[model samples]
Target: MRLVSLLVVLLLSPLGRAAEQTYDVIVYGSTSGGVAAAVQASRMGKSTVLIEPGRHLGGLSSGGLGATDIGNKA
Candidate 1:
């Protein structure tokens, strides 16, 4: 759920271009989805960079959250 929410926010986020270097994909956050995106791109042979403006990473996963209930559909 968090990944999906982050992805939607990322898709709606603004686009940026870097002048110093080049990358096939530039993820602008340190959220789990952002890291996943950068990793998958690298695995697929694309140059990638993750620019985390904040001081943290891993999104809610870094906060020690637990799993949801068995019937969670949201």
Candidate 2:
């Protein structure tokens, strides 16, 4: 009985299942750096995915801070 149970458990285990997805690069956020990383990965011919936790992208840039200057203008 113990052997049979072990065999059944092994048969039902997910050890041999292949992953549903494979990405060369995965960006965890939709912020400027995350977007840039994803873009760079794609530009280098790599598969990439950009995941955002919120309903929008660009973080502060898209959060009503449109007039903020990010770089020095001197």
Candidate 3:
């Protein structure tokens, strides 16, 4: 287990480096909020980095959610 963890760390180190290369905002989540945040940040002239544990882009969106679960739509 330790070796596997170390291998994972080593493999993901590059990604970490890339994320730190230069960014005004680093959003960590694959949810809709995360993508929206990134876009808004970029539009504001801020380099944005969207980091998510999952490989897919949007969490529930790409996972098969026809509609978002924002109970309280402001």
**Predicted structure with the largest TM-score when compared to the true one:** 2
lDDT of 1 by residue, 1-74 (tens): 99999888877776433347877989898788889998999999999999987778887777556465456877
TM-score of each: 0.56, 0.60, 0.58
Best by lDDT: 2
Worst 10 residues of 1 by lDDT: 10-19
Q: Residue by residue across 37-62, what tens digits does model 2's lDDT show? A: 99999999999999999999998878
- By lDDT, the candidates rank as 2, 3, 1
Per model, how many backbone clashes are there?
Answer: 0, 0, 0
Worst 10 residues of 3 by lDDT: 14-23
**Model 1: residue 13 alpha-carbon error in angstroms:** 32
lDDT by candidate, in order shown: 0.81, 0.88, 0.85
lDDT of 3 at 19: 46
Q: Per TM-score, what order, best first?
A: 2, 3, 1
The total of clashing pairs for model 2 equals 0
Question: What is the total number of backbone clashes in candidate 1?
Answer: 0
- The worst-scoring run of ten residues by lDDT in candidate 2 lies at 63-72
